[model samples]
Target: KANNTLKEIAEILMASRSVLLFTHINMDGDTLGSSVALCIALRKLGKQAHILIEDDVAAFLRFLDKGYCTYDNHIIENPDICLCIDCGDVDRFRERKEKFFEGKQKGCIDHHVTTEPFADFNFIDPTASATGEIIYELLKELPVEVDKDIASAIFAAITTDTGNFQYSNTTKRTHLIAAELWDYGVDYNEISVELYQNNRLEKLLLQTKILEQITVFAGGEAAICGVTQEMLEETEGRMEETEGMVETLRDISGIELAIFVKEVSREKCKVSMRSKKYINVAEISQKLNGGGHARAAGCTVMKSYEDTKQEMMRLAEEYLKG
Candidate 1:
């Protein structure tokens, strides 16, 4: 299955002159980094490749777009092929789904277990640690060079998604890939500092607020942290700054499940879920009409922050019991 999909994707890339690429809406490191790497590889092959991202580049990830032209309806161009990376479903594109690249051929490369076969050609690998790993293999099959920039992008994707090689998803292949990227002069220390160490004053203030309101339930087995609109306004922080804040809850001793609920609007809240072990947050997220990995997952609730926190807490407790 893997070989056939790779061959098909290679054929499509070889035949097409213009290619349109996309990722998910929230724009995490894995999605953005993988998309940028692929775009660079395709352009090196003398093909016209453009990344059509719908959201603003997260503050931490803006460096990946340094020399690339990531489009967002500002610059429009029709392409012969459309490819989505790290996105599980077409609906994940949101309104941009109907607006961009009505191409003749469409494909997707994703690592999510619950990914739907929404594209004409699909490469879905649940065991892979990151979509960037799959893209790395695919790049070898294509007649393109894996230069330092592309290697750095792939490194960022793999490193961030694997929690700096600390997550359970890290495997032998994951390390081998990192080793290869390192050989390409990926500057591991610099990337690590940029991704994990650097933080703005606003982000620190927002983190303080989130930590202050954390509540632990189920006898410290479950915890919940919240970020309201008012907190964002007070700190002048953007929604993207809250990226890894939920993991801080999981770090607390005795906490098995951690939930972070951020108010995106008056009646809508985004919930991020993390588990130390055992709990399949993906299943819980699916029940709430969202999907992701077992240990790390997320969902959006159309309710007040209080209601969303209560609902997620209930689900976490139920899962913890079983």
Candidate 2:
């Protein structure tokens, strides 16, 4: 996989004149930060680079480049190449997929285990903690210089995804890469607080409301919560604020699995799932047209809240049984 990805990266970089980069919808720090890091790397190489994110970035990450969160497709017309960061599959690109692939060259760099290697050049390592780790490796391979800004971008990506080197996915390589980044002047404390701390007033209020309804099942073996559209609208919190709140439910005492469902629109619900052991939530995510890792995964369910919640519960029950 490394050899194939390296050859593809070299070919794609050599062939393209301008490059367009993108990541998944409702992107996290890993997705947003990695995309920007790659864009900066390309620009440093004297290539025309742009990042096309799918939706509004989380408030916490607005500090990077206040204007870097969104892009227009008119600007994406007939590019020389398109690179995807932290996105696993084509479908995750949504409407942008057509315009993205319309470029002369296409590539994807991701860290999801379930990804099917769908790109002209693909570098996907499930063993890696985050796509940021892959970008760091790419920097080493291409001899790109890492400045403070680039280091912060890559550092935010890795630390956020690995839960500050605390999650089970945290590996020796993750720590070593982080050590190298620290050498580039990344402030671990500030970035951690910025990424995981500093919740907005409305976001904290939203979490408090959700916590009221959080429920545990089977003697604290499973945890679940639901957030309705009305609730979000009332709290002045967008879908982005729901990112880490799901884990609060997952981390309950003795809980092996956790599920958080939020109304995306009238007919769609975003489902975030996390597990401690012996559960593959990514498999569950794939069933609903989304994916992540064994411990953390997400999917959008298309149905009424009642029906969607029922379906998600059924799947979680089956996973527990298995």
Specify the highest-TM-score model's number. Answer: 1
**Candidate 1: residue 13 lDDT (0-100):** 87
Poorly placed runs, candidate 2 (over 4 Å): 1-3, 66-70
The models' CA-based lDDT, in order, is 0.85, 0.81
How well does each candidate superpose onto the true structure, as a TM-score?
A: 0.95, 0.94
lDDT of 1 by residue, 1-322 (tens): 2323777788878999988788898888899889889999988999888888767888788888865646555444557888889976777788668644487777889999888676777888888899999999999889887999899999999999999999989999999999999888899988888898888988988888888988999878888988998999999877788888888899898887889998988889989998887778899999899999999998889999889988888887787777
In model 2, the Cα lDDT at residue 20 comes to 87
Off by over 4 Å in 1: 1-4, 67-69, 74-76
Clash counts for all predictions = 0, 0
